[model samples]
Every structure is written in C-alpha cells, then in structure tokens.
Target chain A: MIENMTEIAISQLLSETQKMKYEDYRFVTASCVSLGDDGCDVIYHFDKDLEMKHLKLRVGKGEELPSVSKIYFCALLVENEMKELFGINITDIAVDYGGHMLLSDEELESPMAKQQITIVEKKGAK
Target chain B: MSKTVIPFGPQHPVLPEPLHLKLVMQDEIIVDAIPAIGYVHRGLEKLTETKEFTQNTFVVERVCGICSCMHALAYCQGIESLMNIEIPDRAKYLRVLWAELHRIHSHLLWLGLLADAFGFESLFMQVWRNREKVMDIMEETAGSRVIISVNTVGGTRRDISKEMLTKISVIVDEIKEDLKQVEAAFFNDYTVKHRLVGVGVLTKEDAYALGTAGPMARASGIKQDLRMTGYSAYGELDFEPIIEQDGDSYARTVVRLKEVYQSINLIKQCIAKMPEGEIVVPVKGNPNGEVVSRVEQPRGEVLYYLRANGSKTLDRLRIRTPTFANIPALLHMLPGSQLADVPVLILTIDPCISCTER
Candidate 1:
C-alpha cells in the first residue's frame, strides 16, 4: 500500500531523517525534481517493513540544502547526482565529488536546472 | 609492498557495460576501489520530461536491455496509479508470466557471465544456449528478444492465449530440466567453488546498511524482496524470497541459480491460476499527481518515481535502478579482496552500468 506523502520544512529535514534512521528505515533513494519557477522539490524515500515513508524538502534555486549522506551512506551517489545534474547546492556531503561525480567536464552544466534548453515538439501533417 | 593503481573498466573484457573502478592495490590485495560511472549515460530520465507519458515506456525500457521488461513494468505501474486505472486480471497474470520469463532469462544470462568470469568457457556456452530458449520464447510471444514493449500505461499491449501459455509452460519445464546440469556445475564444480567461495563477502548488516537489493541482498541474508510487496499479481502467487546466509560470491551465485528455478515455478503457478479477462483497459485523462512504483527486477528492486503535472508529459521521471543502489555495497566488498578476484566480485553483483548510469 502507498503511504501518504509527508512534506517537511528544510530546517526539519535532518531531524526527520535522524528519526527515520532511529526507527530503522532503510534509505531507499533520493530524487530531485525542478518545479519550474517554484524552485525544486527534493524527496527522500525510506522504507521499513515493506512500507515506504517519503520526506520531501522544497528549496529555491540558490538555496544550500543539507545532505543526508552521513546518515545513509548510499545517499552519496544520489546526492552527488543532484549536485551535478540539477545544480542543487548540497552542503557537507559525506563523499562529495565536488560536482564531478556522474557528469564529465565537457558536458552540459546543470542540465536539469530551469535555464536548460527546452525540448520543443514539432507538429506536422502526416 | 608498493601500492599500484589499476583502472578497471570503461572498456574491459569481462564487463559488457562501461564501469570504471579505480583500484588501489598493495601488491596482490586491493586496498580500495573507487567507482566512476556515467560512461554510457543516455539521460533517459531527462528524456521523459519531453516525451509523452505513453511514449516514455519505450524509452524507459531501453534503460537496460537485460531488465527492460521490469523497467517498463515499473514505469507503467506508476503511470497506472497516477491515472487510477485498475488493470485487467488477465493483464496482471500476463505481466507476471512475462516478468518471470524475464527473470529466468536474466538469471541464466548472469550464470553464463559468471561462468565466463572464471574461465569456464564450455559451461558459459551451455548456460547461454539454455538462455536462447527463453529468448526465443520472448521473441515468439512478445515480438522482440530484448526490450519487449508489451507494457503500456493502463495494461499490456499483447495477450498470451491458453495455447501459447501451454507452450510457454512446456518450455519452462524443459528449461528447468536443463538447468539441473547448470546448477550441479555451479554447486559441485571445483574451479567455481575455489574462485567464488569466501570471496567478496558482505555480511547481513552491511547488506542492509548499504541498501543492497535483489540477489546481492538476498545472498547476505536480508530476506528483502520487492516481490513480497505484491505489486501486480505476485501478492496472489504463493512464493517465498530465496535467502542464503553465507554472503559470499558463491552464495550470490547460488541465490541466483536457485531463483531461476523459483521463477520457473512462479510461471507455472501463474499459468494455472491466471484469470480470463481483457488485457488492456481504456485509460482517459492525464496524470496529475506523483507515485513511486517498485518492482523486482532480475538484479534487484527498481524504483520509478513519476510526477505528472496534468500534462501529456511528465515533470520528472526518476529511476533508482538496482545496480545504482548496489554500488555502495560493491565499494564495501572491494576492499579486503584479492586483486585477481575483482572481476568475479564485480560480476557477483551483476553490475549493469547502463542501468546504474541512466
């Protein structure tokens, strides 16, 4: 069964994550999504006993969010991915890649950001 | 002894996908292993932002050719939940049938690759030869050997008739019979035991703490399987998660080998209990909410998070592939391992770089 989506303030992200860890929920994965002009929403998924609990944090473009990599070591990969792909300024990640983890030096910068090229659809008579 | 650095992939004989592991070795033992991925990242998740939700099934299926059906399944389930459409019972059984078939083929493929990793050439060929039967079944049933695009948003695109189901059942039984020899070789063969046993061990604690999934987690005695969640028809089926406590490369191999038989049994049960109904239901309106769908892929549990904004396209399509989740466990298992065993250890996790990177 699906659990209700829980929205938490950016300030409560760490404390809530710690509580989940104390409750023995396995850190599944973290997802970062661009919400256009309304900044971005970072959802952290955790699971225990086959039930899922999601803790979401919404932040502005220039906001520096805290990383949960220290609590959930596996979050390193996803955290670095967010920093590189979406330009999310994650603070004090455990195994920080300095913005070069998944992407290369030559690729497009922060492709998931709002200023990225928009994919336009062309209509044609078939 | 002086430390030597070895770059493991991005192009390697043993790896079919590009995953570079920077190995820091002290003589014959690897002290550390740092993984560098993204060599083959196609940005398929980003593509979902542009492609229509219906069309993205094909795109997501290409995430990994090996576990394409599971990828499609997860994406379709998420979209179906968003649209609040109940798939037909027949479609659910058909999905389980095809999913089990995919599992069997994927395990067989890993068996072949594992055999090849340890220089068991003839055994590798035999395992793959058996795998061809499954591939042929998929081609005949789904019209594609790899990347079967049978799943849509509401339901499946193809339906298997009772006659075809009987044919599949016969083939599955034949496969089970053929697998005895393969299982025997994996269990009794000296070379395989010597190379795999007590190598690349990850204890139960490390397995959970690092969040490993699928066979890797099962091998470590976690008793974690997404199938237990009962997405689709798995809840209706009678089965148990295969577990091994040894938590070694050999244990991982055994888990997968036994799971192949488990998948065969699951398919037979699905055919016996499959309900008769329409395969696809009409789904109207756009998805306006978010949903996270989880499915048990051959490698592990794959999570697809889809957010729709009441549009034809999705706002975000995030895939937490099994391989990506297993990377931390890989990093943990690498150190304290002999340099020569790196290939076998990497294969033990069934590293799908394309899936991980995408």
Candidate 2:
C-alpha cells in the first residue's frame, strides 16, 4: 500500500495520514545506517498498522523530511531500539534520552557510532 | 474494595518462559492485564545479518525449542524462494515427516503442560510419557533431542534411511495407539471438561479482529490454515485441519488432541508417499532478494520476511511470530473470565513467549 518498503512510500503514507484527523503518532525511535553508506534505515512502527506501514525506510542522509509518527501511537519503542542500534537521532521528536533494553547504561554511546579514525606516529617512513 | 496489583511472572511457577504479567484484581477477579516481554530477547534479527545463510540454521532453530524444526524450515524456505531453488522430492517429504512429528510432540507437550497447570499430575505424566516416543524418534533420526538442526538452505541435513523409515513407521503406529488412549482419557474426564469448557470464549469476529491464527482461530470456526497454501509437501499429503466451533478452552484442547492424531496420520502419509531424490542441494552464491514465507507453527501462522543483499549476511530479517500477533487477542479474552481460569485460558492460545520475544 505504501510503496512496499521505501522512503518515498513513507512520505506518501505520512502525507496521506496527515490528511486524516488522527494526530498522536510520535517518533519513538529513529536509528539505522544503510549497509553501503548510500542510504539510511528508518523504522516507523505505528500502533495501528493502518496508520502507517511498518517499514525500513531507506534514504540519503541530510535530506529534508516531514516527521510522520505524529499521527500514530506508541512508536517510542521502535525509535528507542533504532536509536540504540543505529545511533541516529531525530531532532524534531522528543526523546527519552537514555539507553534502551538492548544496551547497558555505561555503554550509552552506540557501538556503531561512526567516529573518525586518526593515527599519530612520532617517526615513520613515508 | 481496593484492587491490588500482583506481578505474576518473569519467572513464575505457572509460566514456563520468562513473561512478566501485571495483574490488577478486585477480590480474585482480574480487572486488567498487562504483558511485559523482552526478557528472552537475543537480538536474533541482528544475528541474521552477521551469520551466513547456512550458518543461520542453528540460530533460527533455537528461536523456540518446541517449534525448532518449523522455524529452521521457514528460514530456509525464505532463502530457497529467494534463490528459486527447487528442492528434491525426497527432501520435501522428509521435511513434511519431521514437521508433523514435531507438531504431534509439541501438542502433547502443551497438553501435558496444560494438565499440570490444572493440577492433573497423572494426566500430565501420561501425556509426556507418550511424548517420549516422538522425542526418541527425533533423537534416533536427527541425533538431537530438541533443536534438530535438520534444515539447510536448499534442503535438510538428515535423511531417513530405508531401514530407519520402516522402524519409524512401526513406532508411529504405536504412538497412534497410545494417542487413542489419551483421547479417551481426555474427552471422558469430567474434571478436564469442567475446568476447560466455556472458560475462554473467543467469538469468530474477535479471533479475526485480534489477528489470532493456528488452532485458536481454527477453534473459533475460522477456516485458516497455512497448510492450505501448500508449502512443503502438505499439498501432496492427505489431511484436513482439525476445527472446533465452540471457541472455548475445552474446544481448544479438543482441537489440539485431534490435531495430534492428524499429525500422526500425516506422518504415515509422508512415509507412504515419499519419492526418492537428493536430500540437499549444494547452495552457492550469496542470496540476494526479498521473500516472505508462512508456516503453521504449533501456535499459529508465523510470517518471516527476509531481505538479502548478495552478501554472506542478510540485509534485513523480520519475523512476525504467532504468539506476538495473538497476544492482543488473548488480552481481550482475559478480562471477563474468572481468576482461576486465567492459566487455562492463557494456555488455550499456547503462549510461546520465547517465540514472541525473539
């Protein structure tokens, strides 16, 4: 119905649901990087499967997007799991700002966080 | 009267798996029920992305020990469909044979557990004693007691030898006879009927609306069996779904009991109709595609959606287990029933929280 597992389908679904009167869908989780670094994996699980199709929406980073979970219920868990697993943050949605069930408190920074690697050496042959 | 909230289990005597239930009761009548899972979460979906297609069999089989073979078969079938691999005729029949064997053992295990839940210790022992036959057969054939890692990407790992087949058929006949005794003991027992009948009444609409599947939905008069779609060798076998119209706890017990008989018959049918061919095909190349597979697990319809991206690992794997889908429906059926009926009613759907959480 919503373009069979893609980002455009997510946008189309969000737009269609926005036209309806329901307005409680909140982003519970938003975390995931695509395999080849070409796209992202966004899991938007609506309490009512009708409100939104459960999808792994793939898109390039830094793309302008409309927040969709605003029209669904209980998406916090999906967002939380994603955030914990992928380390992607949703600026627009209010987050609980803690580690999820999968990760411990001490290991808050996700393992998958893409930190730049810098090597320093005193004396080396070029 | 103030209602008291009692935490039944993440580990309780009644529940086998680690499922925490918050029960709010007013004078022994449960008013509200909240199910909290995630205790047994193993990040299985995440594991699929790291493990190779062939290596994922053992991992998938451990999803639920009782439905191990079915889960492995489902995962393999998903990959098989994606690769468009045509399984050998013998492998199909062997798969069907093991599937039916697992089904019978699973139902018997549930029946035994249900009996114990109701304080019928002897019935529990009797049913489990019968269960050992299938377990013995599994151990003898597959070389493992619970997680029979028989399934592979293209076909199965174990093959039933002609000599083993004859012995299996003979033992199956013995199990069939033992089942008739159980059938009489269960159906004729007044206490069993008094405890189960009309306790948990799920109407047909409630069953469908709540997305209940497997025996619970079948018991409620909804003719939905994944086998009808003819996955595996079910199309070749001669069997019909065991259905009951009462939609009560007792009806569910009856349905499972009859299904045990059907599974035995179905196993025999597989033996009679098995055609000779290779047990497994050598799978090469990375599986790269999306495929959806449906299998009739002991509980209900289990849906697996697998996406592979031409690598040693999968791109994404989504599992919609039967108990996960049936939980909402079970919650709806709980409020109106008496407190004592809770365990029996809960068992009616055969709650497999491990399968659900995984």
Candidate 3:
C-alpha cells in the first residue's frame, strides 16, 4: 500500500509542488489512471533522501490542470507523456509535445484512457 | 554566424536503439537538443490489462531487455504488496541473486558500449568478452541468458542449488579478476580520460532538480539510491552506494565501474547467506487497492504502480523506467558540448529506448 499519499485539489497542486521544490524534494515521474467518463487521476511522485511523497490530482475528462514542470523542470517529459497517452490537458507544459510525445499521428489517440472499455460495458448494462 | 540543425538518429551507427534528436547548433557547438522517440513504442503496459495478473510478469519482463528480471521482480512485488502477501525469506535472497547478476552484465555491457563510443573498438570487444562470463553464470542458473522470468507474484519461480552457489562464487571471483584488467584500460588510458573527464558535465543541482537516478545521480554528489530502502535482500547485504563528486562523464564511468565490483560482492553475500526453503508461496486471489513498487535497476530506479479491483485482471499497471527519468538529464547534458562528443553523451545515458517507450 502507498502510504503518505495526500490528496490535494487540482488547483492546489502547483502550489504544493512548489513547496516540495523549496523543501529540496526531487520530482519523480507522475502516473495517470483513467476513471471512466474520460476523468482521470494524476499522481505526482516526489522524493527527498529516498523517502517518497505522492500527490494526487483529479481531472474530469476534458478538464485542464496546471503543470508542475514550472516548479520542477524534470516533470516536462512525464507531463508530456500523460498529455499524449491519457489526453490529460495539462496546460503550460515546459516543452509541450502537443500530444505526440510518445505516440505518432497514425496511432490511436489517448490509447491508455479507459473510456472505450467502460463505455462498452455501460451500454451492455443498459 | 548562421545556426544549423543536424538530425541525430532514428538510425545512427552508434545507437543500439532508435532515438532521434534534433540538434540546434551554431557551428560545431550544440545550442540545444530536442529528442524524438516513439519509433518502437510497443504499448506493453496497455497490453498488461488484458492478461491475468500472474501472467503479466512475463509481459513486464519484456519491458527492457537488460533489466528484464528487475521488471518482473517489480511487478511481482507490486502485486504481492497489494494482496498483502508476505514472501519467504529464501525467495527474497534468490530474487537478489538474479537481480544483481543482471546488474553485473548490464553495467558491463554499457562499459563495452562506452568504449565503442570513443573509437576504442579493441577495448569494447575485450570488455564484452569478459561480460560473457556473467552471461554464462546466468544461463547456467536460470536456463536462459537474458529476461529470465524467475519471479512470481508470491515469490521466485526458481531456486539455485548448493552446487550452483559454489560454482557462482568461483565464477564471480574470476569475473572480478577479469574486471581488474579492464579497469586499467578505462582508468589509465589518457585518451579515454580525455574523452570522458570534463565532457557532458551535469552539475549536482541539475542532476537533483531533473531527478536523475542510479549511476547518473550517484555520479553527481547526490547519495540517493533505492537499495538503501532495502526492498529485497539488500537490507541484509553489506554494501554502500558508490559516490563520485566529479559529476562529469568520467565520474559516471567511475561510478558504474565501482558498482560492478559492488554487484559481485552482493552476489557473493547472497550465496553465503542463501537460505534453504520454498522458492514460491501459494498466492490466492487478485490484487486490490494501489501500491508503488520501486527497485534499483542497473541503469537507475524503476517504479511500478498497480491497481486491481478484486478481479484476476489488473485495473491499471503503470511503469516509470529510469531511462525515461534520465532523458531530461540527457537533454540537459547535450547542449554546450562539441559535436564530436555527441556519441559519448548519448551512450553515457545507456539509453534503453524499449524501456522508455513502454
């Protein structure tokens, strides 16, 4: 189980990350999980002397959230990855790949989002 | 002076994998390097959701050819953690034995590539020739050379016998002796130092701020190593994370070399303390809830996030590889270096494009 995971509102994420940076915490990568209905949870991992802290942010489908790349420059690639894979519209990325960070134009868009499967299952239930 | 843009590899002779970088340059010095990857994006993580949680071990193992066992180990560890399963002591030590062997060969393989990057073909061949000894040990113990799928959700699938342990001790000594001979070439050669010493310097501040891992972070002044957290038998083993203050390409080289010996020592310790018992436990039910499993792979730290909703299939499996974490550092190191040293800088990262894309 992941301990010390403190859930923060999406609006408070940027400030919390800035606080982590000021406290000398190194920014680890972030992971995005689709929560059906195009909504998702973005967990930003940070470390200080090998101790990890996880911050979770929720984005409802086409919603936009602030990027931590401004506070922690290392977050650029991972943020870009979440942008492309899960279609989380994290605005103001340090270097935006514009949804092609890890995928090509020919590939399926937001390939990792769980909406398709959820939609199919919901229709079956109905 | 007009600026120039040079494309460096979706296919380059020096690169073992496809990683393209658009070098924004002025004359011979690189002003910026914009990396482009995805030529071989396999979508392995997405594929894992389809397979049963137990079978996903083999799928995750294929994430990186070099750190295959570590990938399986991390996945198994995650599933085990989510299920609240306590693995046996003997199995924990067995996991360490195989994991460190992977480390030995991986660092050795990178050393050979580093030599090849600087036009030292003979040194490259010699180092690889020595590396084959470690590979022989793996093939003997695991019945496979790379990607030995020995880890399971509860514990390990295979165990090493007393005879194999004795053989490993003898072979590890031989590998250490062989490494000493190559060490002279890497450390004493004037040209090797000239290529590495001051080239591709990443300051301690940049390394930490950018979240560099493994040798890259240790090469700088940071003392961050996941082994200190002691996920496997590492807590019982007597070893320390090698530290280098230089934070240059040379320091990175030195750290990896020293770690080669560290891995050998770890293998010997695991053999000496090899507990005799069951290799695997009966793990019942599916993983539920969320957990993050972290392991120190040869290149750096690898993170696995797993969530399951009381079913055989996992709901989510996210992998964050070290090479992915290190790319920002790779971009940070690229600019301001001479064009000729580009190969060394890229090779210094020991880029596993397969792992990054996954």
lDDT of 1 by residue, B133-156 (tens): 999999999999988888988889
RMSD of each candidate relative to the true structure: 5.0, 7.5, 3.8
> Of 1 and 3, which scores higher on DockQ?
3
lDDT of 3 by residue, B1-358 (tens): 7899999998998899999999999999999999998899999999998999999999999999799999999999888888889999999999999999999899999999999888899999988997899889888888888878899989988888899899999988998998898898898899999999998898899999899998999999889889898888889999789999888999999999999999989999999998888888998887889989999999999999888889999889999999999999999998899999999999888899999988
- Candidate 2 on B42-154: residue-level lDDT in tens? 77777777888778878888789999999998998998888889989889999989988899899999999999999999889989998998999999999987888898889
lDDT of 1: 0.88
lDDT per residue as tens, model 1, A1-126: 336568999999889999999999899999889876677899999988678999988988667788888888889999888877777778888877766677675554677876542111001001
Ranking by DockQ: 3, 1, 2
Better of 1 and 2 by TM-score: 1
Candidate 3 residues lying further than 4 Å off, grouped into runs, are A116-126
DockQ of each: 0.46, 0.09, 0.70
What overall lDDT goes with each candidate model?
A: 0.88, 0.72, 0.88
* DockQ value for model 3: 0.70
Off by over 4 Å in 2: A1-8, A11-126
Model 3 residue B186 CA deviation in Å: 0.5
